[model samples]
Target: MDPRFLGIPELTTEAPSVAVVVDVMRACTVAAWAFARGAERIVLTGTLDEALALKARHPDWAALKDGPPAPGFDLVNSPGQLRSADLGGRTVVQKTTAGTVGALAVRDASLVLCAGFVVAEATARVLRERAPDEVTYVVTGEDGRADEDLACAQYIAGRAAGGSPDPAGYLRRAAASRAAAELTQGVRRGSHPDDVALCLELDRFPFAMVAAEEDALLVLRRYDGNP
Candidate 1:
């Protein structure tokens, strides 16, 4: 069970048996948390217009952007705030800088899973059960390659292969990564201290977020990784 890890979503070439879309900075992480909190389903979009359009069509679904809270959106792209959100039986429409877009782009993957440190172990557990011959960890970056996303891919793949990489070390490296610096400079939600830590909290969630296509849109659902 060898798994390939690629940095930058645009560079993904193969349609692996399984594609793990990793966005450690915030997007995928918060989605996992949302599902665990009882959100019915989440629609992920790469473009803000698509997200807005989806929300418009489905007024019941909450809408949010990738960064800070803005007008007409139900939430911001902050894990810190999502941890306390009332997501019970509700659906959310989200547009992130990368994760959702990457998941949608990889149409060849038989199984598309969104993951972060919070669900890393559980995701590994689920992947091991599926045991696809080819797996690609697609790390989404805001602009180019992001160290934090790369670290997340390494951790997820390592855990799935029964190898334990240094979690503390990975966190340390990510904290000082170019992605972190850029987020801070850009004043994005990833810049918040709590938001960063929330994304880095390894294995905090017991379920992996799986994407299923419905009406040509990917909606996320929680899959219990443990028996």
Candidate 2:
């Protein structure tokens, strides 16, 4: 069957056999890098309080939390933060408004894979291999309506179904809007610009992360084979 697309806000009800969580503006991308750098487990939460509570409980493990500046978390949902410190043996707990919440909503999925532009190819490979009865691409957004997330979702769905999507078109539109937002808001955002570049970087990583509910953490590695 062809893959299906769903906005992150719709995930709570329209569950699919396999759900791909897209947080292109950097939560999922950063998580992918955390695994690459040898992070043991990543706890994804929707709120700062939840992440901080987890961190307070697990003091031995290193924790990193990110969200909008107003909420005042440890990180700011930028992939740049992932490179700041070595997380060689730590467990990173992440909290974001859209990404983490979107992920948690589909906890019952047979297969749950985190996705972003950076790991699009890896995500597609995993979907092709699993060949689930149905595939749902969930795009997490800031206000249930972010252009970049929708563009990335469409790109992934198009690619997995043997169809072509205009990656440049989506990137151009998203990039221009983000650049404009930066100038007007003076927010000096890091995730969107870098994320737009990162998402377009195809197959830079060989593996994808799969969430294991029993373990409450992502199981990092490559999909075994193509379906």
Candidate 3:
């Protein structure tokens, strides 16, 4: 299958057989890890209020919104933030800067998969098994263009197409990009250099995260095989 990596806020009804949303720094990264570690299901919200409202209705679920740590959330949208949380049996309600928004925006996709380097190989396997005629990888940059997201898109698309994609080389490019500069320079709102480092780890997991809507809530589940 030929995979096309393109920017967000733009996907077509004639898009592709599958749409893989990439946000390496680090909304999708956090989502993949959250599911891998045994969170019941993650509900992706488009805003903080929506996430909070869901949490209010389902008090047992964990919430991760766009801003700072809220009143009753087990975690936030940072991969580093999720590392120490005990989310063994909880549900996570997440609203991020880009990844979740991109997931919801692409109504044209036959299948939507949330992606990062953590699940690139498995994602490729899933896409390969399905063998879609065309696959579109949406580089869901944080509010705008993000170097990390674009790099991950390249890595995942290259791997899915049976090529040796250099994630390390892409990582170098991301590190030198404007987004990284903002994070390191405190020009960006919700990130630090640690966040930059967290998202750069390539292909960190063995499974792909397939996004499916269950009961109107977009949930990302771990799929070790074909979607």
For each candidate, what is the lDDT? 0.78, 0.66, 0.76
Candidate 1 residues lying further than 4 Å off, grouped into runs, are 8-14, 142-144, 182-186, 189-191
69 in model 2: Cα distance from truth in Å? 8.3
Model 1, range 31-125, lDDT digits (tens) per residue? 98788667988987768888888888888889878766676688877778788888899999988778877777775578888888888888888
| lDDT by residue (tens digit), candidate 2, 2-48 | 66667765665755788887776667777877776677777776667
Candidate 2 worst ten-residue window by lDDT? 218-227
- The alpha-carbon root-mean-square deviation between model 1 and the true structure, to one decimal in Å, is 2.3
Candidate 3 per-residue C-alpha lDDT over 1-227 given as tens digits, one digit per residue, 9 for 90 to 100: 77777777566656566899987767888887787678867788777788888889989888886546668665766776677677888889888878888887763467888887777788888877787888888888844367777777777777777888656798788778776677678675545447667666666788788777788777777777776
RMSD of every candidate to native, in Å, equals 2.3, 3.6, 2.1
Runs of candidate 2 with Cα error greater than 4 angstroms are 12-14, 67-75, 164-166, 177-196, 215-227
Per-residue lDDT, model 3, residue 15, is 51
- TM-score per prediction, in order, is 0.90, 0.81, 0.90
Ranking by lDDT: 1, 3, 2
